[model samples]
Target: MLYQLNQLRDLSSLFTRKEVKRWLKDDFKSIDIKLERYNLHKKNKGSNYLKFLKETYKILEENYPNEYILKNEFLNKWLKSELGNQNSLIINEFRTGKAIADLAMFNGVSKAFEIKTILDKEYRLSNQISEYKKIFNELYIIIPKIQINKYINYDDCIGIITYDSEVKNFELIKKAVKNEEIDSNTLIEILHTKEYLEIVYKYYGHLPEMSVFTQYEVCKNLLSKIPNQELNSLFLQIIKKRKVNNLFFNKVNNEFNQICLSLNLKDSEKNELIKKLKTNIN
Candidate 1:
């Protein structure tokens, strides 16, 4: 059973670092900031955080014994299976972290497994890879399929796994795994495209309902951290068509006032820009 468990772990590690890098680049921003902040805090806190993680790992090892898997896998499989199966799995075994390794089985052989989610620089899989190697010859890092190439020496690993809901081509994932280098930036862009598109879609028809205030606030906060021109362009494009409601009008007005006060912009220049925007809207 331990050997079988190790096999599953090896197969799962086929997800290369390059692939994980790509996924994080694209989708990292889409993750709830509060959760990210908490993870970051945990990572920075050192041994206490490691202890918590180790406890979680210990729980999985204790409960499943032979069928250990990650939370994301359980969620993915549960979503894809029949509704009844989903309910049964969730109610009876999912929460307990024990499920028969149906997917990890081939013929009569079963493999060991390890699952991971939300890869970041601080709590990255790289840190855990060695430990996983010690326990199982095979290790898997389940991530979005779009990032499969990010994994280094994937061909040498057992296999790359992803959620069924992912739209990436399996062949592409296999091919990427063979490559030597993976561009994390490109991967992140791909992962977050859906999130950006969703925000755009929500405000498409109801521009007036668009939360310009929040947009501006986020932009202002992020401006120091991001390229100024790119940030400005993104902000302008998203809020360009949005009608100035009370919140929108007040936010913009406040921003304009703050900018005027902080910079060399005269009241006349500020008013000119406002007039131009109003004219364009009318």
Candidate 2:
């Protein structure tokens, strides 16, 4: 693994000098990391993010063999870099009531990504697929190359993104079919409490005189009553607005990205890291 040294010039805005030093020390320990020192003096030699990322990814995948390697190298880090980070909102381990999704993205339309690593089994996919359908306008199941044929035999509607470790990259094997049956319930579920209330208040009126305890219930009920086209329009509008107002969520998101970047995401370390990142940033 090697780095051009100016990697953190842009990202340093999201982290303090001390944290940046620690992070670069840990995440880039094995690599020639010059990002922090190069950017400290406010001079950017201008590194190509994708090319260096590909080089590091190639090193990690070839050297470290783990069932979850695809997740860190391809699904989380490389994919975001490839997508150009165009102010999109991405959530991992997204939950809606009982069901949890592997990854969810909000851009123009909500998209869900379900990852089934090379070591994972596909037996429980039916229930998850059903749940995701109720919420996401577009759904994709990401699987290792070995699981492609098996997953393809199960369904054709959901898109298939496959990972090939040989090349250490993702291959879009099949484009997902557009989900025509977009549910209004899922649209409301994705919105925050403030967003839901704002939409309802703007469209309907003052809350229907309910207890504050039940405001969520009332707002959800009100949202369900909105016609599909109107409700969907509101959902997209709020998503776009929130993407621009991502300052509120910047710290937490950057922590998750840091975890993936560092490649030391132990289960026990996740909560502590998030807490520390939040505390330090705030």
Candidate 3:
């Protein structure tokens, strides 16, 4: 059964980073074998590639839903739920320190969510949570209902949310408390050299002279002197400046919401995907 589920999870390859780039570039032929292998290429009334993808997604959601599907649900549900606001930016695979958060949301503040599915192991979770705590203002661990007992006794600050496959919605089992101890170094690691330099210039009114070789170290030393609270806010501002297609993100079909947001699509790419998805599959 597990093997079958893993096989079904392969359907997600259509949304993989490489494939998404290819799709944006109008390289649809690359996906032909898998579509034909799964018999998803057969002509159907009123079905285009987008509809085909939606149908494929349904099959995975109903059968072998994996981590990406779980993230898709989280993005679709909470992005507009009471939890999210008008300015909310949903980030996928957000890297902080040594851990890559499953999903991170930037609205009024930064929040990180780590998901553990039935197929996942708990070995690295402790380390991941430890890393997340240093940067995010609030943190939550999303898990399957059967695994609740395994994590229910964790630190009080870490919230627990459970997934109900039947209704396909997430329910908050425990509310996460705000963590104020933001690690400046970890937060700085999230930024590119240019972004961190920009932050330094904004806060100090001028950047110190340093060679490209020594600029990173110099900036790190300078940024470390700033208060963690102030730095955390600055980090939020820097990350939020990244381009996420709000127009298409909110307007696209729910089925495409995850990939749309995850891909960090440019305005032209967004238009390209919309047209590409509309192209009929024969």
Tell me each candidate's TM-score: 0.23, 0.61, 0.87
Count of clashes, each model: 26, 2, 0
Better of 1 and 2 by lDDT: 2
TM-score of 2: 0.61
Q: What is the lDDT ranking, best to worst?
A: 3, 2, 1
The C-alpha local distance difference test score for the whole of candidate 2 amounts to: 0.58
lDDT of 1 at 6: 43
lDDT per residue for candidate 2 within 130-238, as digits (tens), equals 8887766778887878777788867767988887777657887877776645566665676787888888887786767877699888887888788766766677667
Model 2 lowest lDDT segment of ten: 243-252
Local error of candidate 1 at residue 242 (angstroms):
60
The best candidate in terms of TM-score: 3
lDDT of 1 at 133: 31
RMSD of every candidate to native, in Å, equals 25.1, 10.8, 2.8
List, residue by residue over 37-95, the lDDT tens digit for candidate 1: 33434443333322333333343333332222333333333322411221121111101
Residue ranges of candidate 3 with Cα displaced over 4 Å: 1-7, 39-46, 246-252
